[model samples]
Target: MMDYQLNTPLNGNLAMTSCFHENKALQQDTTLYKFIWVRSGILTVEIDHIPMRLEQDEIACLTPLHHIEIKEVEGEYLTFLFNSNFYCIFGHDDEVSCNGFLFHGSSQVMRLKLSPEQSTNLNDIVRIFRQESTVRDNLQEEMLRIILKRFIITCTRIAREKCGVTPEQEKAFDIVRRFYILVDQNFREKKQVRDYADLLFRSPKTLSNLFFSCGVPSPLRIIHERVEAEAKRLLLYTPKSAKEISELLGFEDLSTFSRFFKKMTGESVSDFRKSNTTGSIAN
Candidate 1:
């Protein structure tokens, strides 16, 4: 379980390893984005308490905000961890265009199954990544960034293809991507689809239509699911009371949040917390 890491004083951090469990420090770092590629066998992960399984030749792209628990790994895998300082997705969105589509585009974890050719391409890039990790020079950082950008571009292309996005829908796709980013950024304060629609300069109905055409979740459902996911994460991982979480999530009052939670999920806050806590303890 060898870990190869590159760290710079300017907060540039990147770590690569074949064993995902070996990097406890990186796993706990909230500021890092994670890419988990299952090269062989099965990998199980729980994101925001929802478990997912990845088979061979699959990869999951995750953002900093997600609560990720690597439950099991049955065979070989690769993990790439990097902070914003290494390469800010938002800062260089125009270059790779992965800011929204790969990381923050959906409430669910983004997993892509690689074709044989795609897997070969990724393996080639990873070889270069391993080789570059050993080199030290003034241009090492830039070189690594270039490789990372290439990796991101490859994943973005696969994602676009998997989403069935056509060239004709590229403009609409960008709008949907922007909507996802905006909802991720503002869901705590802005709970309505109309809010995001206004920010995207589209009407709520138009946003719904676009999402429908893309076969993605509806705009309102995306907002509700994002809020619900955060609520569940706080409940399962934090000691904050419901009132505190309600305030943190920008609810006017506890009752409103309580009702929203019950509507989104089928349980009250206390019950949800207790059930998950007991489950964790048992585990």
Candidate 2:
């Protein structure tokens, strides 16, 4: 297990490791975005209470809002972690163009499976990352950011392909990605497709058409799912009562929240929490 880290005075931090357990503190940092690449073997993890398995040559892109628990690893893996201070995806979206597609696009974790050729290319970028990690210079941060951008660009390319997005559809895909970002930022306050459509300066019908053309989930469904995911995370991980969570999530009242939860998840809030707690204890 080898680890290399670069830390800056301005709260910028980046780390690369072959073993997931090498840096427990960084993994627990909610402000960090993580790219977990299963170089070889299988890696099982629970993300936002849902268990998922990643096979060799697969990568999972995780945002700070995700709750992840590494369950098992049967072989070698690589992880690259960076905080927003290191490189703000949102701020630098124009440069890397991975702000929403790779990080905050969906309620579920974004997993990309790599071809052998793609795997080799990513390995080359990672090798450069390793070499740069040992060098300290005035331009070190900039150099690393450049390499990181390349890595993200590569993944975003693969993601576009995986989603069946063609070069011609890039503009439409950008709209969908922007919608996801807006939902991530405002789902707590704005829960309707029309709300985001207004922000994006598109009609609700246009947004739906764009999403349908991209073969992605509907805008309204995305908004609802994002809200449900956050509610589940709060219920399972925090001691906040349902009422408090309802208010925190901008629900008009507890009953409204309860009804929303039931419609989204097919269970009452208390039932969901109680069952999850019991399942944890049983495990």
Candidate 3:
């Protein structure tokens, strides 16, 4: 079961905390970026609506300020919050953290199961994060950036090993990651895969191969997934009726949009919204 306990914000910005035992996740509606590191036990992580199961030493990042919720959060977890202004301290002027809850910038979000050595190193950062009050200095920013970057590097290496991709394949995967970022950003504006491939200066076939190599679906499939995500968001967040949303999403007719939504998400837009209001996962 999923439950939520909202946390009070610190400053005019975000807040970081240490989790004890959580019965419910927190519902944060902030545009500022948020992060979490699993200190112990397991966490079911969802960022911008994408879900993953993360164990100890695994970290999650979120941006785009979409719905990021954690389920099955037992034992210890450390939460961190950041945004453009905050991350600028790290000298990352345009660095994007994946929707603030996901680690999908290829190397940035490698799944790391902390070995003993790595765990010891990460503890230093966790220790700092857990302290409710600390000295905020130049060193503090450097420490957080180093800790966060190293964590992602480690996780990406682990993810590569698990996926059986070599160094060359890994490079391709980075390009694929960039494609996704672009597609995600422009999904509502640019619907077709070619539009993305053209912008990326690659053929659709090359884009398809890149995704296929990364263990995801084809480029077109990813585009559809992007479109479908917007449809679901419209369904859940807006009080606007389905027909209006369908038209707004660029569908010619209500029937066409309804059919497309059903084909992609396996339910009518109205029913999808209805069912999600009822339960976690439904048929």
lDDT against the true structure, per candidate, is 0.87, 0.88, 0.59
Candidate 3 similarity to native, TM-score: 0.72
Off by over 4 Å in 1: 105-107, 278-283
Give TM per candidate. Answer: 0.95, 0.95, 0.72
Name the better of 2 and 3 by lDDT.
2
lDDT of each residue in 1-283, candidate 2, tens digit only? 6598888899998888887665678767778898999999999988887889999999999998887788898999998888999999989889878877898835577899999999999999998988887888899989998898899989988898899998799899999999889888898999988999999999999999999999988999999988998899889888889999999999999999999999999999999999886443211
Candidate 3 positional error at 252, Å: 3.3
lDDT preference between candidates 1 and 3, better one: 1
The better-scoring model by lDDT among 1 and 2 is 2
Clashing pairs in 2: none
Using TM-score as the measure, what is the rank order of every candidate, best first?
2, 1, 3
Poorest lDDT segment (10 consecutive residues) of candidate 2: 274-283
Best by lDDT: 2
